[model samples]
Target: MNQNSKISEDTIDLKELFFSLIAQWKIIALCVILSLICAMLYLRVTSDIYSVDAMVQLEESKGAASAALLGDLSKVTGGFGQKSPVDAEIEILRSRMVLGQVIHNLNLNLIVKDNSSGIMDKFLSQGRSRLTYQHDAVTFTNKQNSLIIKQLTIPEYYSDKPLILEFKDSNHFTFTYKDQVVFNGKLNQKNTSETNKGLWAVDINAQGELLKQSYTVSKLALPTAVKNFNAIYGVSEKGKMTGVIGLSYLGQDPEQITQILNNVLTVYHQQNIERKSLESKQTLVFLEKQLPELRKQLEDSEIKFNQFREKYKTVDVNAESELLLKQNIDLEKLKIELQQKQAELSAKYTNDHPLIRQIDAQISEINKKIADLNNRLTQLPETQRLYLQLYRDVKVNTELYTSLLNSYQQLKIANAGEIGNVRIIDTAVEPVHPIKPKKLIVLILSIFMGGFIGVLIALIRNLFQTGVKDSAQIENEFDLPVYATVPRSPIQETRMSILKKKKSIPILAVKHSDDIAIESLRSIRTAIHFALSSAKNNIIMISGPAPEVGKSFVSTNLATIFAQSNKRVLLIDADMRRGYMHKYFNLEVTPGLSELLSQQVSLEHVLHKTNVENLDVISRGKSPTNPSEMLSSTFFKELLETLSPLYDHIIIDTPPVLAVTDGIIISQYAGVNLMIARYAKSQMKELELSVNRFEQAGVKVNGFILNDIQRSSAGGGYNYAYAYTAQKDN
Candidate 1:
C-alpha cells in the first residue's frame, strides 16, 4: 500500500511538471514562429547547386599495344609498360594544373552572373539559354538567347567585382566601371585584356533579338579559379582494378557545369596523349639518325665484298667452308644488332634500367654465339677461312642494317600518328537536381533548436524571479490569513477601457460585475466582515507592502461588493500624493482628500457618487506641497472617523507601507486594516519589511489579499483554481 501510494504521488508530480510546461505555451509559440521565419528567409536567400558527372578510362591495353608497336625500340627505353597507380591518377585528375585547364577551356575564369534585381533573383526560375558563344563561336542565340560571354579578362583589382558590358546598339558596346564608362568598342571586336593599359578582347555575342541586352562579366585570378574548380571537382575510381574513373563537378548552372566537366576530361585525355606522344617522337629521332648510317654501312660492306672477290678471283670454297661461313654470318649479325640496341638503350636510359640490362644480356648471348662460330671456322684451310670470314662480315652487316631499317620505318609512322590510350567512357550531361542545401533537414533542426531555446529562457527567468507566488506563501510565511487570492482579469479591464476615452475614469465594478476577479472581491467581503465583526469602527484601510501591489484595486472592488450587499460603501482614495480614485469614479479630484485635509473643500463637495449601486467614492484630490504631512494631519484622521458613521463600510485606499508613513498614519484611523499583496509582483522581503514597519508603528494589519494571480507552471499555487475550472468544464 505504501509503495502504491508513492508511485501515485510520483505520477501526480509528473502531471504537475507537464502543467508547468503547458503554462509557458506562449514562450514556445514565439520561439517556433521566430525559427520558422528565419528558416523561410534562409530558403529564400540561398541558391541551389547542381552536379554533373563524366566517366573516363585510361586503357592499360592501349599502353601495352603502343609498346608492341615500338618492337625493338621498346627494349631500348624503359618508359613503356608502366601503368599509373589508380590513386595517383585520381590525384592528377584533381590537380591544380588539370582543373586550371578546365577553367581556362570553359572560360570559368570569366565570371558572368545576372545583377540581381534587389532580392528577386532567389525566387526566379533558371532556364536553358537559347544561344551560347565562345571564342568567337556563336551558338543558339537569337531571341531570349541573349549575349552570354565566352570569355572576359579583367585587371587584378576588378577580379571578383562586377563590370558592366552594356550594349548600346546592334554592334556598339560600352564597358562601364562604377557607373562610369571605361571604354567604348564594337560588338565582336572589344578589348579583352587583363591590363588597364591595353583593351580587353571580350568574346561575347548577341543576335537580332538580344542586340540591346546588357550583362556583367568578371575575371577571377588563376589560383582562385583553380581552388573553386577543385572544390567542385570530384574524382573516384569506379571499382577495384576496373581502370574506370568518374569525374564530377557541382555548380548553380547545369549548362555551365556540363561544359566545364567535358572540357576537363578533354584536357586530361589530351594531356595524356601528349605525354605518350613525346616518348615516341624521341625514339623516332634516334631511329631516324641510326637508319641512314646503317644503310650507308650496308652498302659499303657489299661493295667491299665485291672488291675482295674481284681481288682474289672469287675462289669457289669447299662445302664445309660455306657451312662455317653461314654460321659465322648469323652469329656476327646477332652481335652487331645487340651492340646497336645497347647504344640506343644507353642514350635513353641508365645502365641500371631494366630494358638496358636486358640489352646487355642479349649482347652477352651474341658474343657466346660468335665464339662458337669462331671455333668452327678454325677447322677450315687458311685461304678458305679468309674468304668465309669476309663473306660472313658482308652478309652479317647486310642483314643487321636491313632489320634496323624496317624497325626505324615503323617507329616513324607510329610517332607521326601518335595516339594515347585514354578513352572517354562517358561524357558529362546536364543534371536535373541540385546537390546542396538540404531544406527539410535544416527546417527540422531549426524546430528542435527553437524549442530548446524557449525552454532554456523559461528556466532562466524562473530561476531569477523575486516575486511572491500565492496565498499559501502569504499565510505560511507572514502568519497572516489570506482574505482572497485574485486571478488577473485583463478581459474585464479591457472591456472597461474600450468603453472609456483616454484620461477618463476606469470603473471595473460598474461594467464587469460578473468578472472572475470580482468574485474574489466577494470572498474578500465575507472575510473582512468576519474579521471586523468586533472592530471599533466600520472603516477599512486598504494598504500594501510596496507600490503597485494593487491596493486601490482590492479596495475599490471590495467596497463595491459590500455596496452590492445593500450596505452603503464609501471608497476613499487616501493616497494624497498619487491617488487615482477620481479617475476610477469619473469625478473631480480638487474637492477630495487633499482638498479636505488642506481645508480647500467642504466634505459635501469632496464626496462623489459612483456609477456602481450603493457605492460612493472620494478622490485623492490634487497634489500637495507636503503629502506626508497632509496624510499625518489630525484632520485626515477626523475625516475618516466622520465618514465611518455615514457609510455601512468605509474603505480607504492608502499608499504602500514601506514607501511612506501615509498608510501607517491612515491605518490608525481605521478599525480593520487589509494589506494587498500582488501575486508574482509583491516581493517576500518587501512584504516582511512592511509588516515590520506596521508592527513598529503599533498598528495591527488584520490580514492579506493576494491579487493578480497569473496562469502558468511557475504560478503553481494558482493551479488549483484552474484545475477546478477544468473539472467544471468536464
Candidate 2:
C-alpha cells in the first residue's frame, strides 16, 4: 500500500513538470514564429540562378585497326605499341591549338557595344551627326559650336599641308589649322604637324560622279567594360559527360548574349574538325616515306635470284645416275617431313622445342654432306657436277622480300583510307530547361536550419538560468519537501490608465482560479498551521535569500489569513533597508521599531491597525545605518519575547539573508523560521546558502514555503491540499 502511494506521488510530480513547461508556452511560441519569419525573409531576398546543359557523344577513331597491326609488328621487334583512340581524342579536345582557333574565329577580342537601349543610350548617341552635300562643302552644327567645311577629301595634295578651320558661336569665332587651334580671333593661321592633320581638304579637279562614303567612328571613347566568356565542361548525370557553355553580360542585353553563344559554338565545331584532320595528315606523311624502301628490297631480291640461276651450271639427272637420283628423292622426302614436323611443332611448342632441336641437327648434318659432295664434284670437273645450292638460297630470299613488299603496299593503302578515330555521334543541342536555383529545396533546407538554430539558442539560454522554474527541480536538487503553492495575482491597471485609454484588462481576480501566486500562499498557510500545531509557539519568521521576491507581501497576507480566524496576529517588517508594510497600510514608518526599542514609545503606539479586522502591522521604522547590529540587539529579542504572549500568531518579515545578516539574526529569535522561495525566481544555490547560514547559527528551520508555484499539478494542487487535510484530520 505504501509503495503504491509513493508511485502515485512520483507520477503527480511528473505531471507538474509538464504543467510548468506549459506556463512558458508563450516564450516558446514567440521563438517559433520569429524563426519562421526569418526563414521567409531570407527566401524572399535571394535570387534564383539557372544552369543549362548539352550532351555531345564522341566516336572511336577508324585508324585504330591498322595501328593495332603495326603495334603487333613493333612488339615483335621489342618496341612500344601505338596509343588507343580514346586517349588521343581526350588530349585533342583539351588542346590549346583547338581553343585558340575557336577564339580567333569568334572575334572574341573585338569589343562591340550592345545596340539595346539603356540608361546611357541618349548620352552615348548624342554627338553623332550625318550630313549630305550637293558639292564637297558641308556644315556641322551643335548647341555649343558650328563648323563650315569647304571641302573634304582623302590622300590629296592638301593632306600634306595644314588646312585652316574656324569654329563660330554667337559672339566669337575660334580659328584652327587642321585639328590644332591657332587663335580665337578672326583668320589666324598656325603651323601644324603632319600627324595632327584631319581628313578634310579641297581639290580643284573633280570627277563626274560625287564620291559617297560615310566614315563612322565613335565621337567619344568610353571606359572599357570587359566580360569573360568561356565554355565550361564537366561530368553530368546518366553516366555521360556534359557541358554548360553560357554567355552573360552585366548591362541587360539579351540579344548580345544570344549572338555571342551562337558565334562561339560555330567556331568551336570548326576547330574540332580541323584538329582531327591534322592528325590524319600526319599519318599520311609517315606512310609515304616507308612504301618505296619495301618495294626496292622486293625487286633486288628477285634480280639476285635470276642472276644466281644463270651463273650456276645445273642439268636434269634422271636414270643415268641412280645413286644421285636416290639422294635427291631422299632430300625431297626429308624436306616434306621437316615441313610437316614444323607445322605440328608450331602449334604445340615455341622455337626452343625438342622437335626444332632435332630438325636443326639434321639440317646441319645434311649441309655438311652436301659440302662434301660439292668438293668431290669440283674435283671431277665442271661437266661431271650436276648439283647446285646457290639458286635455293636466292629463292628463299626472293619469297620473303615479295611478302614484305606486299605488306608495305597494303599498309600504304590502309593509311590512305584512314579517317579520324574520333567522330561526334551527337552534337550539343540548345537546352530547354534551366538546371539550378531550386526554390523548394532551398526553402525546406532553410526551415530546417532555422529550427535547429532556434533549439540550440534555447538550450544555451536554459543552461544559464539559475531560478527555480519548477518544484521538481527544487526537490531533485535540494531533496526538500514543497509545503504549498500559491497562484499569482492578476495585475491591476490604474483607473487613470483605464479611463484615458478605455483598455480592458485581460484577466481579473477570482476566488477560485488556478492563479500561481495565490495558490502558493495558501499552501504556505497550511504548512504554517501544521508546523505550529506541533510546536510550543506559533511565532514564524518569513524570509528569503533576495529582495523583491514577494517575501513581505507573503508575510502580511499570511497574517491576514490567521487574523481572519479571530486569532490575534502581529505582522512585523523586520527588513530595515526597504520595509514596505507601513507604506502598504498607509502609515508612518518612523516611531515604530526604533522608538519601541529605545523605550521612548510603547509597543501599542507603534502597532498600526490595517483595513482588515484583527490584523495589525509593526513597521521597520526609520532607516538605520547599522541594521545588522540593531537586528541582533538584546532589545529586539526582548520585543519579540513581549509580542510572543500578546498574539496568537506573530509573522515577522525579514530582509533577504544573502543581502545581510539581519534576517538570519532575527530568525534566531523567532520560534520557527520558514524560508520563502519564489517560483521561477529564487535559485537553488541561494536557498542552500540560506539554509546553511541558519544551520551554522545553530537555528533550526521549520520548513520551506514554496512561494509563487505555478497553479498546476506539479505545484501541489488540489491533491496536495487533500493530502494535507487528511493528515491534519488524522
Candidate 3:
C-alpha cells in the first residue's frame, strides 16, 4: 500500500487546529491584556491636540467668448495652446509661488519647533560660574611657580543679601560686606640683576561678581542668560477621500495655537485673491493698448475709402466704356509680350530646365487672366454699371471698418471690468476634538499584531523541531498504521488525588479520567488492534524521534490495559541511558535490563511487580558504556525472545530512535514497532527520517502512537468518560 493510502483522506480538521491554539489561550489572553494596559497608559500620558481647517476655490479668469476666440485661433493656425481651465487651476493651487507666499507671510520656521527644551538648559543657569580653584602656590627648581586660586560667583539677580567671600584657608584672605577683598601673601622680591615684571591675577566674589582694577589693565565679566522655550506648529489628520481638512497646533499656551492658525488662514485667502487680480490687471493693460491701435486703423481706412469715392465722382457712360476697352487691351499686350519671351527661352533651352519652365508657366497664367478679363467685360451690362459697382465697393469697405472699431471698443471695456480668479470656499473653524492618538484603535491593532506575531513564531518553531508530533502526519508519509494515542496526565498533584481515592488492588483498575483527550486515545487504541489483524505475539515496541515524547507512559499504560484483560504483559524500560521505570514501579533500579544483557543476571531476576495484577516491569538496571552496542547485542535479542513466549503482550519503552539508533536496532526483534509522536512537539521530517532508518535496518514499523493530543470540545473525551463510568457501575 502507498504511504498516502495508509491514512484515510480527510479535510483538514480546523477544530483540531483551533484546539491547539486554544491550549495556548493563556498566551493569547496575556498579549491582549498587556496591549490594552499599554494603550491606556499611552492615552493618559499624551496631551490632547485640536485642529482647524480652511478651504479655497479657483475660478476661470476668461469667459466663454474668450474660450471661443482661442478655439477659433487654434483652428486657423492648426496648433494647440493653453491648458483647459480645470488643469490650469489645479497647477495654480500647487505652485511654489503660492506656497512661498504662505511661508513668507506666516514665518512658519518660527512657528514650527525643531527641538524640545534641552537637558543643559534645565540644569545650567546663566551668570553662575561652577569652576573651583585652590589658594596655594608651589615653586619649582626651574623658577616656575603655581598658585592655587578659588573662584565662586552667584548670579547678579540675588536679592537682599550682600555678597560674601569664603576661602578654604581662613588665614589666606579677609572679606568685607562691601564689594572688596584683602589678599594676604608673601611680598614680591625685587630683582637687582634684571627688571621685575608686575604679577597678574584674577579675583572672584561670592555674588558671582568679577572685578579687576589696575593702572595698566582692568577686566570685569558678567553672566547673561536667556530661557529656552519650545516652538509649536499646527497639524491635522483627515481621511484620504474626506473633503474635510484638519488643522492643529502645539504651543506652551493654547491661545497661541489658535491665533496662529487663524492668521495663517486669513493670509492664505487674501494672497490667493491678490494673485488672480494681478493676472487680470496684466491682461487689461495688453487689451487697452491694442484697442486704441485698432480704432486708429479703422478711422484711417474709412478716410482713405471716402477720398477715393469723392475723387472719382465724374461718371460718363462712353468714357467709362473706353477706359474698360483700354484696360483689356493693356492686359492682352502684356500676355503677348510674356508668350514671346517664353517662345524664345524654350527654343534655346530644354523644357525640363528651370528657366524654360518658369517662362512657359508664367506666359500661360498671363494669357488665362487676359482671357478671363475680356469675358467679364463682355458679360457686363455696360461701362456705366461697372462704375456703379466700384462706387458700392468703397461704401462696403467703409461700413466694415466702422463695425470692427465698435467691436474692439466693447472688448476693451469688458477686459477692464474683470475680477479676481480665486474665491474663498470655506473658512477655518476651531476643531471640537483631536484627530489623533486614537486609544481604542491603537489597542485593537496592538492586540491583532501581537497575536499574529505569536502564531507565526509558534508555527516557525514547530516547523524546525526535529521530533514527532501527530500520527496522521507519520502514517501519511510512511504508510503505517497508528497503534495508539496517549493523553498526557495532569501533573503529579492531580494524579495523586485519584490514586488516593481509588484504593484499588491494581492501580490500572483506577479508571482513567474521562477528559476529552483521554477518550480520543481509546479510539486510537481500537484502530491499532484492527491493524494488527493476525500477527502473532502482539509485542509492541514504542519509541519516539527524541526524548520526552511520553513513550514510557504509553508503554506502561498499554501493558496495564492488557493485564486488566487477564492477559499476561511485561512493560520493559529499555532506555538504559536514562531510565525511570524503577521509580514508577516502586523498585530499586539494580539488577535490571543492563545486568541481564551483560549476562550478570537472568531476566526473571530483574523483573518486578507493580501495583497492578498480571503486569510486570524490567527497569533499566544500571549505567553502561555504549548503550547502543549493548542493546544491539545477541544477548538482548535472546532476552526478548525468552520474554515474548512467556507473556501475552510485551511493551518496550525505548529511547528516541533519532537521538540514538538503538531503538531501530531493538525494533528488529519486536513483532510491532510503534513510533510515538508528541503533538506540537515533534516535527514531520524527523518522523519520516526515523521511519526510513527503520525500514533500511529491516525493521517493520507497524504503526505509530500519537501522544498528548489536546481536546477542543467536551464531546471529545465522552467515550473515555463513559467507559470509566460503566466500569464503576459494574
Candidate 4:
C-alpha cells in the first residue's frame, strides 16, 4: 500500500510539473522569439565558405626518361622498374618547393585590403575578394574599389608587417611604415626607394576617395605563406595504390580558392616534368662520357685487328676458330652490359641487396663463359689465336659503342618529350555555391535549441516552487482535513478587474449566487455548522500562512453563503494593517474595527448592514501601527463576544499568521480557527509552520480551506463546480 501511494504521489508530481510549464507559456514564447532573432543575426553576420577541388593521376611508368633507357633492359633483366609512390607525390604536392612557386606566381603572399571598410561593411559584402564601396566624390566602378597593385617587393625584415598607403588623390599615394613616411609616388608607375630599414618597390592604381580611404599592404614570409596554404589545402590518394591524387582548398572567396588550387596543380605538374628532365640529363652525361672511351677502344681494336690480318694473312682457316672468336666477343659484350647494370643498381641499393647481388652473379657467370671461350681460342695455333683475340676485341668494342650510342640517341629524344608521370585529370573551377552556414538547418536547430532552453527554465522554476498543489497532499502531510476546495471563479476575477479600474468591487456570492466558488463556500457552510456544534462560540477565524492566499475572499464569501441560508452572518475585517473589506460593501473605513477596538466608536455604530438581506460588515478602519497589540487586547475579544450573539455566525478575516501575531491573537477569541492555502501558491512548509504556531499558542486550527485552485487533469486535487448546466428561462 505504501509503495502504491508512493507511485501515485510521483505521478501527481509529474502532472503538476507539466501543468506548470503550460502556466509559463508566455516566458517560453519570449525566449523562443529572442532565440530566432539571434539566429537570424548570426546567419547575417557570419560569412559563407566555399570549397574548390581538382584531381590528378599518376602514370604507371617510371617516367619517359627512365623508360627509354631501361625499358628493354628491364625485359632482359626479368622486369625490374620503379614507379613513384602516391603518398610521396602527395607530400610533394604540399611541399614548400611546390607551393612556394605557386604562391609567388599568384602573388599570394602580398596581402592587400581596404582599411576604410568597417566590419559591418565587410560582413555585408559576402566575403568578396575586392572591396567595392563609394564615399562622397569617390568613383567606384563595376570592378569595385579599384586599388590595383601591379608589383610589390619587400625585404625579409618587413614580412607580415603592415604598411599603410594613404592616397593623396586618385593617381597618387604616400607610403608609410611604422608611422614614418617612406616614400610618395604616383599611380601607373613603379616606385622604388631605399629607406633606413630596407628597399621598397611598389606600383599601384586607385580610383576611390583618396583622402577619405586608405589601404594596407603586408607581404607574408615565404614559409609563413606556405604554412598558411597548407592549413587551407588538402590532398590525398583517391584509392589504395591507385596513384590518383585529389586536391582541395577552402576559402571565403570562390574565385580565389579556385585560382589557388589551379595554380598549385600547375606548379606541381611543372616540377614533376623538371624532375624527370633532370634525371635524363644526369643519365645523358654518364653515357656521353662513356661514349668517347668506347669509340677510342673500338678504333684501336680495329687497327690491331687489321694489322694482325695483314701480318697473318687471314689466319682463320677453320669454322671452329671463327665460332670461338664470335662466342668470346658475345660473352665479353654481355659482361660489359651486366657491369653497367650493376653500377646503376649499386647507386640505388647496397651491394648486399637482391638486385645488386643478382647483377653481380650474372656478371660472374658471363666472365666464366668468356674465360672458357678464351681457353677454347688458346687451343688453336698461335697465329690463329692472335687473330682470334684481336677479332674478339673489335667485335666487343664495336657492339659496346653501338649499344651506348643507340641508348644515348633514344634518351635525348625521350628527354625532349618528357612530360612527367603526373597528368591533370581535372582542373578546379569557380564554385557556384558556398558550403557553409546552411540557413535552413541553422534556423531549425535554433528553434529546437530555444524550445529546449525554455522547457529547461520552466522545469527549473517548477523544481524550486516547493508549493502544495493537491489538498490530499496537504491533508496527508499535515494530518488535517480540508473543509472545502474553493476553485478559481471567473466572477471573482471580473470583480477584481473592475476594482483595478477604480470601480466598485462586486460581491461574488450575492451577484453570482450560482458561481462555482459560491457552491464551494456552501460546502464550507455545511462543514462550519458541524464544527460550531462543539465550539466555544459561533465565531470563525480565517487566516493564511502568507498574504494574498485569498483568506479574505473565503471569509467574505462564506459569510454570504451563511446569510443566504437564513442565518445572520457578520463579516469583520479584523486586520488593521492593510485590509480592503470596506470596498466589498462600499462602506466607509472609519468607525469600524480599529475604531471599535480603540473604543472610539460604539458597537451599534460600527455595525453596518450590507445589501445582502442577512449579512452585516465591519471594515478594517484606518491601518494602525499597533494592530497586533489592538487585536490581542481584551476589547477585541469582547467585540467578537458582543457580535457572536447578534448573528448566527461571525467570520473574522485576519492578517497572515507568519507575517504578524494578529491572526494568532484573533484566533484565541474564535470558536474555530482555519488556515486558507492557495493552490500552487502557498508552500507546504509555510502552512506547517503556521499550524505549529497556532498549536504553540494554545489554539488548534480546526481545518484548512484550499483556495483559488486551478483544476487540471491530474486526479488527486479537488475543486467544486456545477455538474450540470442550468436551464435557461424559455
By TM-score, the best candidate is 4
By lDDT, the best candidate is 4
TM-score for predicted model 4 compared with the true structure: 0.80
How do the residues 25-101 of candidate 4 rate in per-residue lDDT, one tens digit apiece? 66687878888888888888777889999999999665676677776666778755578888899889989999988
Each prediction's TM-score against the native?
0.78, 0.50, 0.47, 0.80
Write candidate 3's Cα lDDT for 171-222 as tens digits. Answer: 2333223555332222232112111222323232211111111111111121
Give lDDT: candidate 4, residue 712: 50
Instruction: Provide the lowest-lDDT 10-residue window in model 2.
Output: 721-730
lDDT of 2 by residue, 680-722 (tens): 5788789989889999998877766665544355334332321
Better of 2 and 4 by lDDT: 4
Global Cα lDDT for candidate 2: 0.51
State the local distance difference test value for candidate 3.
Answer: 0.53
lDDT of 3 at 20: 49
RMSD per candidate (Å) reads 6.3, 17.4, 21.6, 6.3
Q: Quick one: ranking by lDDT, best first?
A: 4, 1, 3, 2
The alpha-carbon root-mean-square deviation between model 1 and the true structure, to one decimal in Å, is 6.3
Pairs of colliding residues, candidate 4? none
